[model samples]
Target: MADEDLDIRMFVDGKGPPDIDPYFTEIEGAEAIAQSVALRCYTPKGYAPGHNIDAPNDGVFLPDFVQSTMTPHSLFTAKTLVHGEARKVDGVDSARVSVTGDQAAQRMTISVEGEGVDGEFEFSLTVDPSGLGVTST
Candidate 1:
């Protein structure tokens, strides 16, 4: 897919205003999961292969450490709604947040389904702190 299409968005202030319902029905659980995902961001852990790099600074390269959905091994833990979608009354959307220190970018994916109050929504956020840096190799 194109680069733009691969991007995701996440809400910063945790859950929004009063009317906005968060995808994570349980506030406490959602917060915990979100925090866990945040931890996965670009950490100074792991190794870089093939090159003469001194050591494993901090990078989860393409193939080995790649992760899309919230996998079992993910450092984060979340309590999602029974049916996936957050409650409607809150007016918030579903979301996932991830942090990649190597990329230096925070990503969030929000799915808003309706026009107004009756809309269905969801989101995923990823925080990539790595930015556009290349490993020394």
Candidate 2:
């Protein structure tokens, strides 16, 4: 990688859970060199509405408003490097970036001594020059 080609930046757009919008703000403070990319990410959790039930007056007393629990959202990011030449076919140059991590949206159910969320989530990101486009075979 050439020193001028190396760069560090945050990807601004991606596909993920609905309502969870991700926007790349800026790249981390580092040297911008060819084949070199560095960045940090911050993700916020989506807010949900809570339900409440209530009863009043003489007769009988009922619980007023139901208690709700909110789940915390986490963000997992990875930094990777690509060392390969761009493939040119049909007058187009293409490259690929692969990202491996966890899918923050997959929720799992768990019932042990107490109630908890459990599940397996896999994150695999492939950035091709031509997204979802037919390749020259």
Candidate 3:
């Protein structure tokens, strides 16, 4: 297996008890990278312990657009931040990011495309006051 980890869905959805067989299922390769990228984009810099020394301030920096209006400049900045973090994943070779928002909904969508060791993958995440949600695309 090429980099394996416990399936995060088991924890995220609070699916039943942990003793079940499915709870311990592992995700590998591109799937693993996709999950990693989603987490990297969601985590704030300095929040994760033992972070990269060179880029101490890694991860997406979501601007406070709740109090203010969302602008093109802010969207562009978000895309850049997400792209930078996505590219830093160990198995990722390249990454592209797109950011769009709905001012009225107070939500932002971030889409990412990347080539990983196993293959190419795409996924999108939504950020709102409630929380962040990820979906594979």
Mind sharing the TM-score for model 1? 0.22
Candidates 1 and 3 compared: the better one by lDDT is: 3
Error of 1 at 131 (Å): 7.0
Error of 3 at 120 (Å): 0.7
Better of 1 and 2 by lDDT: 1
Worst 10 residues of 2 by lDDT: 57-66
Task: Tell me the tens digit of each residue's lDDT in model 1 across 1-137.
Answer: 22322212232354211122344333322332232222222222352222335444333322122234434343222223211222222333444322222212232222212222323323343222222111110
Worst-scoring 10-residue span by lDDT in model 3 = 11-20
Tens-digit lDDT track of model 2 for 1-137 = 23333223323243211121144233211211110111111111121111132312101000000011212221111221121211111111333333222224232211111111112111223222122111111
TM-score for each predicted model, relative to the true structure: 0.22, 0.16, 0.75
- Clash list (residue pairs), candidate 2: 5-34, 6-33, 6-34, 6-35, 52-66, 53-65, 53-66, 54-64, 108-118
Would you list the clashing residue pairs of candidate 3? none
Off by over 4 Å in 1: 1-27, 47-123, 126-137
Cα shift from native, residue 80, model 2 (Å) = 13
Q: In model 2, how large is the Cα lDDT of residue 2?
A: 32
Give one digit per residue, the lDDT tens place, for model 3 in 24-134.
Answer: 656666655666666665566655412444556676545354335889988887788778777877778998888889999988888888787768888777777655666
lDDT, candidate 2, equals: 0.19
